[model samples]
Target: MQDLVNLKVISLFHSENLVRIPELSSATKLELINLAYCRKLLELPSSLQHLEKLTHLNLRWCKNLRFLPSLYKATSLTTLILSDCSNLFSFPEVSPNVRELQLEGTAIEEIPSSVESLCQLISLSMEDCARLKNLPTSICNLRSLEVLSLNYSPNITTFPEMSRNITELNLQATAIEEVPSSIECLSNLCVLNLARCRRLKSVSTSIHKLKSLRGFYLRDCSRLEIFPEILDTLERLRNLDLSGTALKELPSSMENLIGLRQLRLENCESLVCLPESFHKLKSLWFLYVYGCKNLVIWPDNLFSAIGGASLTGRVEMQKDLHGLSSLKELDLSGTNLENLPTTIKQLTRLQKLILWKCERLKSLPELPPSLIHLDAHDCTSLAEVSSITKLFEQALLCKDKPYTPKTLACLFTNCFLLDQKVVASPGTPKLQMLFGHMFTILKDYHQASPQRNMFTTCFPGSEIPEWFDFKSSGSSINIQLPSEWYYNRHSMENFPGFVVSAVVSFQDYFDDAHFHIRCECHLKSCNGDCPNLSCSFTVWSRRGLHGSRLLGSDHLFLLYHNELVRRFVETQASNKCIYKEASFEFYPGVWERNWSQCISCEVKHCGVHLLSAATDDAEVQPPKRYKYVS
Candidate 1:
């Protein structure tokens, strides 16, 4: 130590064998010392008090360390961290100049009254201090403190008094039963998190005084039955989550939060309905009410009020369901909704609507043209869907204009009622015409941008379509390609691609289960002059088919793969090699650890159809050498 007088920093981080540090008194110029993760170290050298220039010291993860020497004499110290010192029972006196102190994961039972001496402290964290029971009131004297976190302290039953300058306070997973009205003193607070506080019952109405607050989280407060009313407009509040609570209704004044952008009420089973004034939150773009089974009614003018559209009578209720123009996603899964308003199509910007397991919903109205994804899996009572022929007719009307393809996906797994109705009315244009119209739309989109267009659909079925050029009983199929099969010779109006289909069945039921169908392709040239070309693509299911139980039933899965196949063939054209044979293998893939148990999808049948611009009908017949591997 005497030879290192010029040392400005000393770091023995992660030195597991280190038990003691040599006296640092000789290193008078040292400004920082770190001995984090030194598990065997019991105590720091007392000579540390002599370093007047020492400004930072970190002893994090020193599990065996029991006590820290007072740092009162180190006047220059501004940051001190003793986090995860499991054996440490007492708080060490720190210099008043210290700006940050962390004692998280420690054995300290309480903060002493002397803590007021840290008048310059700006941040203090005591999270995961399970033995800690309370904080002294003198802590409010820390006028410079801006952040305080006591999360995961199970024994804490009361909120501590905080300074007026505080900005963020987190008390998650605590035993606190109520938020004291004194919380109003934190006029500058920006965030308040009380999530998972199972014992919490009520919040002070004075919470409205926090005019600067931007986020409030009370999620999983299972015992909480009431929320404080916002006596005044909380214009700055942007996010509020009350999920997994027992609340039955929201105060009508909730509409006063004009800037609110996201609201989550998931799993609030007791919630019956929203206040009539809820429609006034025009800025809200995301609203989730999943699993609120008792929720049955919606304000007649909910959507129209938000969009400033005109409202009409009951006969016109379905006609006036306009507005909510800024909303992009709406989830009403596991609810009691009986039917959707007809004019819901007026929401010109909505992109996704999830209604999984809404068993009471009997039918659907016309959907908005902007919708790109729709999931109605396991909707047993859903017997009719508004005519999709109208949508196709509109597309046909606009065929002369420059095409701009929109990606689309629709899932209807286990929709027995709807499938039974469609099967009974085989001549019905609703479901029967869908395949032809969808194919036409796909062709038009592919002709415009072969590399960017995609379409996917899943519905109840037991066999592959007869139009597919090559068919196989199992999962793999092989076919031969004629020379120049990649392009059409007659005109450049169509682009080359493949339409792949499969009939798959699930062996069992699993919650939140999902799997992807992986297609691995191998292409080889006739003369073996070019190297083998291999590529793969996946067809993913949306939202893990929530609540899906498709046991003993088969579903038809179809999708278009133009980008990969077209790009590969164009690159091969430059090689002047004739690719004559191609083989495709299909298998199920599970990517999530929890979903690994859901790998029971059996591919019963598979088929492939090739599209070429040179062919007048756009369908290329399979060569005589076609082979099938069962």
Candidate 2:
């Protein structure tokens, strides 16, 4: 120890066995000491007080540390961290020059008034200090303090007056009942979070005075029945979350928030409607109001005003729905609407439309051409989906032109009415036409480009179409390919790959069950050489309580993969090698639990079909198994 007189730094990071640090009496020039994650460290050497050059002292995660020596005399210290010292019960007096002090997860009961002596402190965090009760009012005298966090301090029943220079303040899950009007004095404050403060009932209207405030969160404050009206424009405020609150309505003055971009009001059951001027927020792009059961009506002119806004609620259809030209996603789950306005087809850029539990919707209108995903999982009253036939017809009409391929995925998991009406009809002509149109689109899309796009659908059915040339009773199947089968002498399209089909039967209802069909493909050449080219893709996934209720019955899953399969087979073809046999093994299961659980499923049957553009008249053949010969 005597030979370390010139030592300037000491770091014992993660030394879990270190019980204590040697005295630093002789190392007067020591400038920094780090003992982070030294869980067995109980205390610092008292000789540490004599080091005049010590500028940084980090003791983070020292769980057994129960006390810290007074650092008031260490005038040169600028940073001190005692975070996660679970056994420490008192705040240590730090030097006036200290710029940052962290005491998060400590057992400290109260902050000493002498904390005001830290005039140069820039940040003070005491988050998750369960035993902490009150902060010294004298802390407001810290003129240089900018950030203060006291989140999860349940005993903090009153909002502490803070320094005027404060920029960010977090008091989430505290017991504060109201934000006093004096809060406006924090002129430079940019962020204020009071989320989950169940006792919070009111906020001073003076909050509008925070000219630089960018985000304000009051989520899950169940007792907050009203929000003060904004009298002036707050152009910099971008995000405001009031989800899980009890507010019945918003003040019309919200139109003054011209720069707001995201607003979340999820599960606010008491909220009946949005303000009439809600459309004035042109910059708002994402709006979520899911599970607001009483929110049955939308403002009449709301859609026409916000040109590109995304919203979800029980919409009261208006004559014109095309005003939202730039909207991309819309979720109207759990609504009572019976039908969508025909103008929905005018939303040329709409991509995803979610209607998970709209039980009263009896039919679907023709959707936009840009539609990619349509989720109507449990629409019990839906009996007509003729619009799908029109979509296929449109694709057929444009088969000759060069265009980008648009993939589509539709989920009709438990539409019992639709299944009885369409799949159970006398000859099932509609069902057959739907499958035929889908095939035409797949062929047309493959001819355009090799870009990977998938088309998948899920519906109630028990049998595979007879067109599939290869069929198996279980989950595995093998197919034989003729030499030079990929090359066609007729048209320009190289090869139109194959389609896979599976029948899955569920045993019992599973909450949040995500069904997936994985296929492992292996290829073998005529020379006995085998290349393991394995690939798997998710064929079907479903969630939500309503969607899983009726999933106990059998359902059919279909997938079309042209480009994906081509990339694999063509790799071997380029080597002047031909794969005479291809084998596939299917595994179907739910992601939520193991196969032995009460919620289980089995793949009852599997089949495959190959597509070719060489001939216009193709006939369905009998099932045949292919084997590789050495």
lDDT of each: 0.74, 0.74
lDDT of 2 at 601: 72
TM-score of each: 0.83, 0.82
Top TM-score model: 1
lDDT for 316 (candidate 1): 17
Write the residue-wise lDDT of candidate 1 on 1-630 in tens digits: 467689999899999999988877788899999999999998788878878999999999999999888789898999999999999999888889999999999999999999998989999999999999888989999999999999999988989899999999999999999999998889999999999999999999999899999999999999999877888888898899999999988998887788888898999988866777776887778788888876654566563211111122111122245335667778878876667767678776677788888776777778776676777877778777644534433333333234344455667777766555244456543343455556555555444442344456677777665456678988788877656743333333343467787888766734343556766666666665433334333333544424444455887788665555555555653344556766777776565754242357788888776666555453433333433544
RMSD of each: 5.4, 5.5
lDDT (tens digit, per residue) of candidate 2 on 1-630: 576679998999999999998778899899999999999998888888788899999999999999898788888899989999999998987779999989999999999888888899999999999999978899999999999999999999999999889999999999999999999999999999999999999999999999999999999999999989999999999889998899999999998888887787877888877777776776665566655666655655543211111245434554345244555676666656677767678777677787777777788888877777888877888777868756644433433334344466777777766555345457664444466556556555444444555567777767665456667767778888656654323322434367888787876756466666776776677777765655455544565533456467877778765556656655644355555777777777556554322236777878777665443433322223422221
Off by over 4 Å in 1: 6-18, 28-34, 51-56, 303-320, 385-407, 421-433, 448-451, 487-495, 509-514, 525-553, 563-579, 592-599, 614-630
